[model samples]
Every structure is written in C-alpha cells, then in structure tokens.
Target: MNIKVFIYDDNLSRRDSLKALLELSPELEFAGEAINCSAAVQDMETCFPDVVLMDINMPVVDGIEGLKTIKQNFPHIKVLMQTVFDDSDKIFECIKNGASGYILKKDPPQRILQAIQEVYEGGAVMNPSIALKVLEYFKPQEQKSPLSEREQQVLQLLAQGLSYKMVADKLFLSFHTVNSHAKRIYEKLHVSSLGEAIAYYYKNLHQ
Candidate 1:
C-alpha cells in the first residue's frame, strides 16, 4: 500500500510542487494539502494521512504547535518537518515534541521522498546540515563521557532516534531501568531535556 502524505505549507508553489512530486512516486499518495495547520487536528483527521509533510514556518499556526497537537491526538501518524533554513531552536522543539524527521526545503526531491519513507518505516531522519546544527546547538560544556557502558549504549540508541521503550527492548533491559539510565545520563551530562541529551550524545559520545 502507498503511504498517504498530507502537506501543510503556506507556500502555494511548494504545495503544488509537492502534489506533483507525489503523483510521480508509486510508493506515496497525496492524501490532501492545506494552507496552514491552524486546523491541524481537523485536517489530519479528515485527510487520514500516514505521514504529514509539515512546513515549520507558517503564518497562523506553525508546525511546532501543529506537531504537538497531532502527536497528542494521533501518536501513530508520522510527521516530517521541512524548513528553508536550519533553525536550531525550532528543530529542537520539533524533535522534543515527537517530530519523526526534519529536512531542508531546498533538499533534492529524492532526499525528501526518502525521508518520508524512512519516517513511515519508523526511522528518524535529519538533514546532514540540520544534524550538524543540532550538535552545535548544544555544545557540551564538558567533553568527558561520565556515562557507564550501559548508559552509553542507551544514549547511542536514543541518538539514533529510538524511543526509551524501543531501546529497552533492543537491549533486553526493563523500561524502568532504561529510564533510570537516561535520568543518570542527563544528570551527568548537565543537560535537562531530550533534545539536549541527543545533542550531547552527538557532541560527546557519538563515534
């Protein structure tokens, strides 16, 4: 079955282009398109999309709030955010709020298609430039990895965009134990949020 994609971008040209692109791809179907996400929930509920192509910067309701609403209501639907530039703060916010992927507006068509597929298949994707910005956004104050071997393993999985539960299952550890290691990792890294922790992982621990 083709993955259904809904677009939420204010740019008419971009929306049109995306619609045309979707028509060309056998793996994707254009469920619907919207001007903005002001009615994010209603739109998603109506369109019944498997993945959403969300524009991060919209006029009335930007992707951030729309992402929040969708994740809150329809946790299974994947969202892939696109922006004209690598806005690190927005990127951090989106990731923290459960955005499945982030990509540049200027990225080639093939990459965008690949991102949608990857996210639909439960993998997190980030533009390389955006990934670099995410690391620089939270430049660790310390380089030393205070994390134990288990903590490092947990963090590495998290960095790959695995959820805590997924990491626990992959490592054959209880979910509560994984949570404990995550908490310890945060305390040791002097970071307090998921986005910051992932950034710290890339900055300090990622090989």
Candidate 2:
C-alpha cells in the first residue's frame, strides 16, 4: 500500500516543495494539504493520511498546538513535526504531546522521507540536538533505587556494573538466590535502568 501523507504548513511554497520531493517515491502518495491548525484538523478527518508533515509556525494555531490537536483527535495518524526550531523545549513538548517524529525544516529531503518511514514503522525520531536535550533533561530526574542493607550490597556489586554471574560469585550466594534478590531490589526501587538505580542511591545518601 502507498504511504499516504498530508502536509500542513502556512507557506504554500514549502508545502508544494515538500510534496514534489516526496512524490519521487512511488510508495508515497500526497493525500492533501492544510495551511493552518483548524484546517489541518479538518483535513486530517477528511483525508485520513497515515502521516502528516506539520510545520511549527502557522498563521493562526501554530504547529505544536496543531500537532497536539491532530494526535488527540486522530490518535493513529502519526504527526512528524517539520520545523526550523531546534529548541529543546519545543521538541520535548512535541514528543510529550504525542508527536511521533521531529525533523528540522532545513534537513535534506531524504532525511524527511526517512523520518516519515520511521514514524510509520512505530519509531520516534528527533533531531540529534533534540535527543541530547532529552538526555540532559532526564539525566537529573532519573529515579534511583532504595534497596535495604543486604540488598544494597547486592546492588553495589551490581552497580560496579558486575554481571549476575560475577555478583553471585563475589557475594558467595547461589545464582538463583542472587537473581531473586535482584528482582526484589528492582521492585522496591521502582527502577528499570541501572543508571536510575545509581542516581537513586546518591539522591538519598542520608538513608
């Protein structure tokens, strides 16, 4: 099946240009176009495009709000934010609001095509700078574990980044017992990642 796409941008020239570039792919079909947020939403209902290429700045509602609206109303239609702004907050907010992908307006046409494909395949895309921003934002906020004394020993050895086998050997515990303790540690801490567990340990140092 052809990948149907809708373009939402106030600039007629940009919208047409994007359409022309994407038309090069036999697998992609231009479904429709909308100049502003309201029209975009209406067009989405009408066209039901599989993916939407949306600009950040529009005449009335702007891209972010339009993205939020589209995602809210048409949850299955993935919106790929096509904008000039590399601002971290904008990217983060877009993702938080259900944007499936983000790409700079200045990116090569090829990259935009790839982004659409990625979003269609259930993947999230973001500019490299935007990715770094997310990492920075989450780095400090990542959760840490609160293991008990014995659990802490198990985790500390694990934090040394030891493998389960090594931790089991060093702690002189059966591998099965060590695995059970690790599972409990993960549950008590409410953490899924080792980095979060490590950060948790430092945050509650007084404990």
Candidate 3:
C-alpha cells in the first residue's frame, strides 16, 4: 500500500521540495500540506494521513506543540520531525512529545522518504547524529530488570551450563514450569536467546 503523507512546514521552498520528492516515489502519496499546525487536528482529520512530516520551527504553534496536539487527538498517526538545527534539546523534546521519527533538513531526500516509510510501518527513525545525542542523553540512566526470584534462579542455572531439564530437576520443578520461568527470565532481561541471557547474567554479575 502507498503510504499517505502530510507535510506541516512553514517554509514554502522546503514544502515544495518535499512535495516534489513525494511525486517521484510511487510508494508515497502526498495527502496534504499546511504552513503551520494551527489547524493541525482539523487538517489531520481531513487527510487521515499515515505519517506526518512536521517542521520543528513554525510561526505560531511550533512542531513540538503541534506534535503533542496531534498525538493527543490522533494517537495512531505517526509524526516525523524535521529541522535544520541539530539541537539535542529540541530533538529530545520532540521525542518526549511522541514524535515517531526525527530527521535533519540537510538529510538527503531518500533518507526523508525512508523515515516516512519506516514510521508508517510502525518503526521509529532518527538521523545518526540525532540518535547519538538521544543515546547520550539517556545513557546516564540505568534500567533495572524486573525479574522475579524464580526467574533469576532459572537464568543463573542456565548461565551455569544447566539445561532446562536439569534446572527443573535441581529446583524440584516440572519441565513446563521451568520452561515458563526461563521464558519470563528472557523477557525480563530483554534477551532473545539463552546465550544472550547468560551473557547478560555474567555482565551484571561482574558489574
């Protein structure tokens, strides 16, 4: 399906350029365009676009405020932020305001289109530099795992080279119960495989 896109930029030249780029890509459809997000909810309701390309700076209602409004009114619509300034504060503010993607105005047309498609398909997108800034901003906070005692026991046993059956026997649990505990452990640790779970266990142990 062609991804429906709406643009909200005050710059006529930038809006025109984006429209021209959309015209070239068969996978994208230019649903609508607006100078600012003054009528953001009304315009979005009118177009029902799958994704919105939003400019960070606008005349009256800025993109950050616009993003918050759009998300509040239409939580399902994905909004991708665009800006010339690579300011980390604005980028983080957009993210906190529920923007699905962030891109620089200097980014190539193809990258902008890719960001649209990605957000439309339920993926978040960000420019490399913006991503780095976001990472740095969030790197200071540590995420604590919410593993239960039994789940942690299961992970520790798995890390110690014990198979699920062996762990079950040692812990006096049924095989199915042990498997369930292992699954919960993997989920709490956010690891896909036993190896990753074991690695996480050892990494935390040393930390």
Candidate 4:
C-alpha cells in the first residue's frame, strides 16, 4: 500500500517541489499540503496522513510547536522534520517533541522519500550528519564502570545465579578467594547484599 504524506511548510516553492517529488514515487501518495502549522490540529484532522514532512523554521508556528501539537493530538502519526539549519538545539527539540526522523532540506529527493517510508513503517531515520551530531552530544554522557575486569567476571558469575562455592569451582579458586572478591565488589559498587551486587552488575557493569 502506498504511504500517504502531508506537508507543512510556509514556502510555496518548497511545498510545490516536495509535492512534485512525492508524485515521482509509486510507493508514496501526496495527501495534502499547508502553509504553516498555526492550524496544525485542524490540518492534521483533515489530512489524516500516515507521515508528515514538516519544515522546521516556518514564520509563525514553527515545526517544533507543530511537532508537539501533532504528537499530543495524534500520537500514532509519524512526523519527519526537515530543515536547512543543522542547529543542535532545534534538532534536540524536535526529537523530544516526538519527531520520527530528521533530515536536511538539502538532502537528496531519494533520501527524503526513503525517510518517509521508513517512519511510516515504524523506523526512526536521521541524516548521517545529523546522526553524527546526536552521537557527539551523548559522547560525554557515557559513564565508565569502575569495576576491574576480574571483579566484573566474579559479578557476572554471581549474576548468573552462582554461589560463591560454585564461582570458585568454575574459576579454580578457593571459596575464600571468591568471598573476598565478592566483598570487594560490594564495597566498590557501594552495594550491600548479593542481590544488590547482581542488580548493579546488570545495571552498570555487565555490558
């Protein structure tokens, strides 16, 4: 079945160009178009499109507000944000507001069509440059686990429901050695019990 697409952009030329591009694809149907998203709720109700191509920087009602309005009123519909700017703040805003994909307006027509189909089929799409920026934003937020490799091994065995004796037998270590490792693991993780240590392993250390 062809996926129906709607457009929300203030530029007549851009909207027209997009409509023409959609017509080139046998798998896509151009449901409708709009000047801006000031009447986003009503416009969405009228089109009921499977996907929306939203220009991110309209004059009055920008794409971020329109994206939020669409998601609130019609959570099932997928919205794809298109913009000339690679502004990280707006990219984050659209994502937070439930945009299914983000792409540059300068992207090739084929990429845009592919993005529309992808979002319709329940996949999130991002332009490669945009994806790199997203990765860069989160790079500094990843925390390194402080547990040593051997301690992590002990924790992994414990997480797999092994007792201290069983862990010692598997690793060919003394039971006291496994017990001592368990105590150090708990101290390093700031967890008190075996269950707590196992939970921390799953939450932060297990990889």
Show the colliding residue pairs in model 4. Answer: none
Each prediction's RMSD over C-alphas, in Å, is 16.3, 10.4, 11.6, 6.3
Off by over 4 Å in 3: 141-207
**What are the clash counts of all predictions, listed in order?**
0, 1, 0, 0
Write down the worst ten-residue block by lDDT for model 1. 136-145
Q: Per-residue lDDT tens digits of candidate 2, residues 57-160?
A: 88878888888888888899999998887888788888889999888888888888889889998999987877787888888664454567778888777777
Please write out the lDDT profile of model 4 over residues 94-199, one tens digit for every residue: 9988999999999999899999999999999999999999999878676677787878888999999998899999999999999999999989888899999888
TM-scores of the models, in the order given: 0.68, 0.67, 0.68, 0.68
Scored by lDDT, the top model is: 1
Ranking by lDDT: 1, 4, 3, 2
lDDT tens per residue, model 1, 1-207: 999999999999999999999999999999998888888889987989999999988998888999999999999999999999787788999999999999999999999999999999999999999889888877856565788999999999999999999999999999999999999999998999989999988877777
**Candidate 3 lDDT (Cα, 0 to 1):** 0.90
Distance from true position, residue 57, model 4, in Å? 0.4
lDDT of each: 0.93, 0.84, 0.90, 0.91
Error of 3 at 197 (Å): 31
